[model samples]
Target: MRTLCSSTLIGEALLIMFAGLVAMKLTDVGTGTIWAVSGVAILLCVLLCGAITRPGAVWVGWALQLGVLASGLVLPTMYAFGVVFGALWWCSVHYGRKIDEFKAQRAAAEQAAPAAA
Candidate 1:
């Protein structure tokens, strides 16, 4: 779960950086605001990666997604990008949990087989 989620977050961080650059090129928004927003997004990404094992971290992850979506207020293009990344985040969490469950089941089965032998 941690591994998969972290991988998705790394992708998200890259996207945020790209969005920042694109916004710089396309929007009338000041460079300072763009930098601040991008910096916050990147910082949240780092926090998400580090806090994977901590309690309530999932909520923080969700908040970060909301922040991404909110960036659309500054750069309208971010609305589309935010939705795309939001779906990706959902997949990462949902499928990542499934993968973790499968690993646990496989480990349990292996242990049981050894015990039976």
Candidate 2:
């Protein structure tokens, strides 16, 4: 879960930076406002990577997803980016959990096998 989630977040950070560049060119908002938002969001992504396994971290990721989606208001291109990354987030969480469970199950089975021998 950590690995998958972190990967998604790191990718998001890059996307957000790229979107910031687009916003700078295409929007009326001050460069400061654009970069500030982008900077905070990028920071959140990096920070979230470390805390991915912690309690409530996934919820924060969900909130960040929504925030990214909202970035569409600043630049329409972000709507597509937001959705794509959102799906990536969901897949990472979903499949990562399954992978973790499988690993645990395998470890238990292996342990039990030795005991049975």
Candidate 3:
């Protein structure tokens, strides 16, 4: 589940960045800089999510995510989007732990069952 959550967060980040870029281009809002910056931020979130998710990288990922959220404030829409992304990050963190626990239990059960047989 942690892996799934990580993938989901990464997917969301990519989707948001792509959508924002496309919208800015189509609307000609002259906010190219905004979109570009957001895209980079989201990309960083993707990396952070992946990193922290792997046990030892948690602090780094958390810090980077916070930075991304803070930087998103320049645009209200981006800020909202950042909040959603942050939620994903939280879910990934918590869910990943639970998933790891379940996997460990399942592995233990499997090993025990074979021995019992």
lDDT of 1 by residue, 1-117 (tens): 798789878988998998899899899989899999799889899878988768888778888888889989978887887898888888888888899899999999999998999
lDDT, model 2: 0.96
* Per-residue error (Å), model 3, residue 88: 1.8
The prediction achieving the highest lDDT against the true structure is 2
- Steric overlap count per candidate: 0, 0, 1
Q: How high a TM-score does candidate 3 get?
A: 0.64
Query: Per-residue CA lDDT of candidate 3, range 39-81, in tens?
Result: 6757775775556546656665556556556654443455666
Residue 59 displacement (Å), model 2 = 0.6
* Per-residue lDDT of 115 in model 2: 100
The collision pairs in model 3 are 52-57
- Which regions of candidate 1 are displaced past 4 Å? none
The lDDT of each candidate is 0.87, 0.96, 0.65
Ranking by TM-score: 2, 1, 3
* Backbone-clash count (model 1): 0
Model 2 misplaced regions, further than 4 Å: none
Residue 77 error, candidate 1, Å: 1.1
What does candidate 1 score on TM? Answer: 0.91
Residue-level lDDT of model 2, residues 3-81, one tens digit each, is 9999999999999999999899999999999999999999999999999999999999999999999999989889898
